[model samples]
Target: MEERHVIVTYRLDHATIHELCAQLEPDLMSAIRHPTGIPPLLQVLSVLHFLASGSFQTTVAIASGMSQPMFSNVLSRVLSALLKHIRSYIVFPQVGDLPAVKGDFDALGHIPNIIGAIDGTHVALVPPSRSEQVYRNRKSYHSMNVQMVCLADQYISHVNAKFPGSVHDAYILRNSSIPYVMGQLQRHRVWLIGGSLYYSPKKVFQIIVACCMLDNLALCRQVPFLQEDGPAGGLVASVEPLDSEEEEVEEEDIDNGNNVIQQYFQ
Candidate 1:
């Protein structure tokens, strides 16, 4: 008896293929040792999953049409290599290094004693079966606390990914490297801007100013200004403010116009 054979083909660009290969193990021997080449689609799929869904490996495997074992292996290999090389070099900012800060901000504008802005985002997670009580948040959802610090120019300076679901934002800031970094600002004019009221807000403003000076552009762009003729015939521009007075009057009328029955119903 004769066996049947099948072949398949797909379109791919060279640049994308190079990027895919870049995620594989760097050493030639390590690359050769894998009997199965890193399936191109798996590497791409894993990245998409992390970026778009933030799903676990098991969930991604089901969605990507690959077996669990294969998916796990592919994800592990890809993530390991990525974290080892790219993340190590790319993901962090120089916490205490003035020289590094100067270099990152020099061309944008001019200010001193600035690092980055910090904020926190929640990631959904499976509650720990053993410590389920601790994992439940105020909203009763299980999640992981992810804290990120970005500069005024929007470059992520730090990311603290290892924290419990129930950790408070202040608690995370207090316990992590953020406080230490801020604590070292005794002599420098540097500062950090955060939503934390407990921390020094004045210093945060200074940091934001420094960031703006370093970047040579406003941290955020203003709404496009309406063009108008200036006194000397030059173009003067300004933003239109929202009209909230009418809404306020309507609300007041509704409140005062209410009869006893309506007030009772309310």
Candidate 2:
């Protein structure tokens, strides 16, 4: 075992990591024994190290005292198990829970009706063997454009990582089933603050608005690595011309939503 801080780099403490390993072992353990097979704990640790450091798989395998091939096999098994049990950990609040969700956001910044904040960040990846151009972003990087919506408490309420890096933030949301999910909630007006890239007011149920960078819930929670890189950098979408009716409705919603937070600062 490493130092406490080093252990924390995996994003969980030793006891918690061991508990997760124990839970997954029943489902992940081999039915027949191989004398040289890696233990489940070691397998989990190998994957965690790879993720936290973003190192090459071979490097992580060597560090974990296993061959690269074995490391890949173990990584696959651990990842499959985690995906199977993801729902137990990551959950979204139901429509009936909107009041409580709104209350949490209101307490943070006096912003009414804000259920969450949405944003997209690019996760860099090595170029694939074929059709690599599709993954090249505006910045000319090969990556995945991962969109996420986080609650006031910094827990991610929604995530869509299916898009390639070249896709725009608003396009991902527009194509996703999120609109359908939000439409199902017929009770209250819930809003999600986003950047210019997501400012499409016609999507009434999924209100996207331009917002200050530093004033987000994600920043307030002191997300590690943010201090190193600073705020996410991206191109701001140019404001599109709107019809008179649409412009009026958009302005009304923006003013009504942001006024309280502005007054609170005064």
Candidate 3:
């Protein structure tokens, strides 16, 4: 039997580290009030290492030569502090922030009559226990339901990540706080393009029903109404098991459309 030892070393980028340190101020302050004796950076490192590797907290702490309890405390505090401070900055668009619609269009090379695009993607997560039924998706895996709206410039304009994988895309859209801000006190019509999943009969009706409940919940505060019977109709469709041929066709169409959109924007 042969045993091998490997050593790896890399230079740390000082400027990037400094920026990260500056961002840690709020977390540092919170840590000082915490009973945990671990330093804020070490705790943050514990969390970063875990996230970067998707390892358990205990494993991360052991690999880092830190106590598990201290590491957990620091990770929790740092995450809470950072999320509290930076969430608003990273996850939303301003009111009236839709893309330009037909004004001096050709001169600026802007696509007229386009407001926004909506899409759903999956983010993988560690599988939880069976008790977390709502998190287990149809694929029998755990994931986060990620819904994103990007502008014509291709920047992520908004993100809705509060729902579990089991939740449908329509459900997230209906429950999101985005429509309230975008459609408040005005007839804001954003061009929504999505797959059948977004316009499935069950899903569309579900979103409509959810919107109604939300309206009632908020004393009839106007929310973005889904046009179930208009041009915006048939956005999402119910999930169905796809045959290989159908799946391949869908993939090819998606790839071709993505390339065209990318080239046009470029």
The best candidate in terms of TM-score? 2
TM-score of each model, in listed order: 0.51, 0.67, 0.51
Better of 2 and 3 by lDDT: 2
Q: How do these models rank on TM-score, best leading?
A: 2, 1, 3
Which residues of candidate 2, in runs, are more than 4 Å off?
1-6, 31-33, 196-266
Candidate 1 lDDT, 1-266, residue by residue in tens: 00110000001222332444555536322632344333443454344343233334445555455444555445434444544443433243444675566555554446555566568865544454677766566778655566777664565566665666688988888888777766676456566656511112222222222222222211222112222234322211222121112111122222232331132223
Can you write out model 3's per-residue Cα lDDT over 21-80, one digit (the tens) per residue? 467766675556423344444444445444433335555656555545544555555555
Give the distance in Å from residue 202's predicted Cα in candidate 2 to where it truly belongs. Answer: 33
Instruction: Determine which window of 10 residues in candidate 2 has minimal summed lDDT.
Output: 204-213
Query: How much is the lDDT of residue 70 in candidate 3?
Result: 45
Question: How accurate locally, in lDDT, is each candidate?
Answer: 0.43, 0.56, 0.44
**Which scores higher on TM-score, 1 or 2?**
2
Predicted structure 3, TM vs. truth: 0.51
